[model samples]
Target: MESLGIQHFGAFVLACIALALTPGLDTFYILARSGREGRTVGMAAVLGINAGCIVHTLAAVLGISAILMTSALAFAALKYLGAAYLVWVGLRMLLARQSARQPTVTRGRGLSAAFRQGMLTNVLNPKVALFFLAFLPQFVSMQAPHPQWGLAVLGVSFIGVGMLWSMVLAMLGGQVHRLLDARPHLGQWMDRACGTVLLGFGIRLAMQRQQ
Candidate 1:
């Protein structure tokens, strides 16, 4: 770590842990999936989100994230796309038709769909790219031997912490789902509630300005 010019390693870990614990879109998304589907699908969403973070980390290393930071058009385009996608997902959930059959935990294609949704949600948000560009450098020494590698390490560490937290959320959500499984209407209510939050998050993302 010293060779790579990373400073305040302990502090960085703590910050990452704190951020992971904080409720955010990722947390909501994972919980929604777990509560609606099952733990397996929720874990899939967690992996997808981490994969998206990896993409952002690579963009930071390659300086692609700089375009989002510098170009308003590019940023807005991604922001709108992300907002639209979120709204679409939210609407689907809100408008979902309850089946006559008893609802069970989703599997198979559902897992893949959850993963894709998580990845797209993370990837389309331009703020996340900007965040990596802005946040990761704080712990990296400007005089580091390999600044790019330093960023990668820090990014991976952050994602690792986040994954751990996300897994816990998935488990908790799953337990909630299990408890509410017998009450199908309650699950529907949970779906609607989650959908409403997602819609609000989308609108907030659309209204946010670059800082």
Candidate 2:
């Protein structure tokens, strides 16, 4: 029904697609996990990201993001927390030592660990919450009589579309997995590299200010 979300349908879809395609922390996380792990873990990670986005959508709908965005102190506080979380995750990865039976351990603890990490990574980003706060309202139709519903629709649409692209990225990790499967030692180095990338993202996020 048009009441659902027909206003600016073309524009909304375009905007959602553009944002989904844009490379960001989410993309990097999925790719990193997939390349390090495999499709199963990657898919779990994708689900975790979506689960985190669900919280963002709810926060935006409930106006929590509004509070964070409008208050400088609040924004900075959340930003730092997110940055710290990223750095901690990165450190954990880097400092983790692989034992001789690392492959067995990895196989033993697969999708669940990846899923939790993915969810935590997205939820702690705070920037994702801010992004939803800023981006979703643009496509919400005033004529919808219930702008909140319109916002919800836009948020869900973004999530669905975004997840589609994320899955593609996760699949691409399959290539990396195959490449490094033969070189077990390289996998350790690869995790360290991904850990470094996460640290970089944390530093970048820490330096961001409301614009």
Candidate 3:
């Protein structure tokens, strides 16, 4: 049993790393925002994402994710909520008008706001919850052992891997932000690009099948 658990843990680590590396809506949003807002905001976003991952882990452990996966109404409700949140974020970005002459505030209460944004971005996405529901269970051997414990460990591993990946992304985005800060037009373009990507994701999420 110990050997099996070790093997399962190893496989779970590999899978979590792969998932973390894969580009997703969260990645794009964080990268773009970090490039525009600076490392402080980017790190805040990463922290928020970690917080959301904790929620996902908890949901998986508590079987809430299974309820969401099996119930069409619950899934649809969450799906729409996620979609709406993304669209709202995009709209907010589109409406923002920052002047080039205004001094850039790299350090402010903005980090907290960015962190909250990151949390919402992940927490609202039903697909992420569903992904955990489906993916984590596949790793647990129901007949061989304690499936719940296996799932819990795998879920926590995924969150840890995701946080590591997001931090790397945030650092990269910060570098880009430094390069682009001198060019307000470039910053504006980045904002627009992020808004577009977010809007697209929201639309795509809305079109997803409830099942």
The model with the greater lDDT, 1 or 3, is 1
Per-residue lDDT of 131 in model 2: 86
Residue by residue across 1-211, what tens digits does model 1's lDDT show?
Answer: 9888788999999999998988899999998888778788899999999999999999998899999988999999999999999988888777676652445223235789889989999999999999999999999997977888999899999999999999999999899768767677787677778778989989999998977
TM-score of each: 0.95, 0.90, 0.89
Q: Worst 10-residue stretch by lDDT in candidate 2?
A: 99-108
Best by lDDT: 1
Candidate 2 residue lDDT tens string, 86-158 = 8888877777787633862234468998788788878877678888998877676557767778778778888
Going through the candidates in the order shown, the clash numbers are 0, 0, 0
Query: What stretches of model 3 exceed 4 Å from their correct place?
Result: 1-7, 102-109, 144-146
Candidate 3: pairs in clash: none
What is candidate 3's lDDT per residue for 1-211, written digit by digit as tens?
A: 3423334667778888988898998799789768878877898899998898889878987889888878988888888998998888786666567775443332244788788878988888888888888887777776645667777777777888888899899999999988886776776666667777888889999999856
The count of residue-pair clashes in candidate 1 stands at 0
Identify the runs in model 2 with alpha carbons over 4 angstroms from their true place: 1-6, 99-108
Question: Lowest summed-lDDT stretch of 10 residues in model 1?
Answer: 100-109
| Higher-scoring candidate on TM-score, 1 or 3 | 1
Alpha-carbon error at 166 in model 2, in Å?
A: 0.9
Which model, 1 or 2, shows the larger lDDT? 1
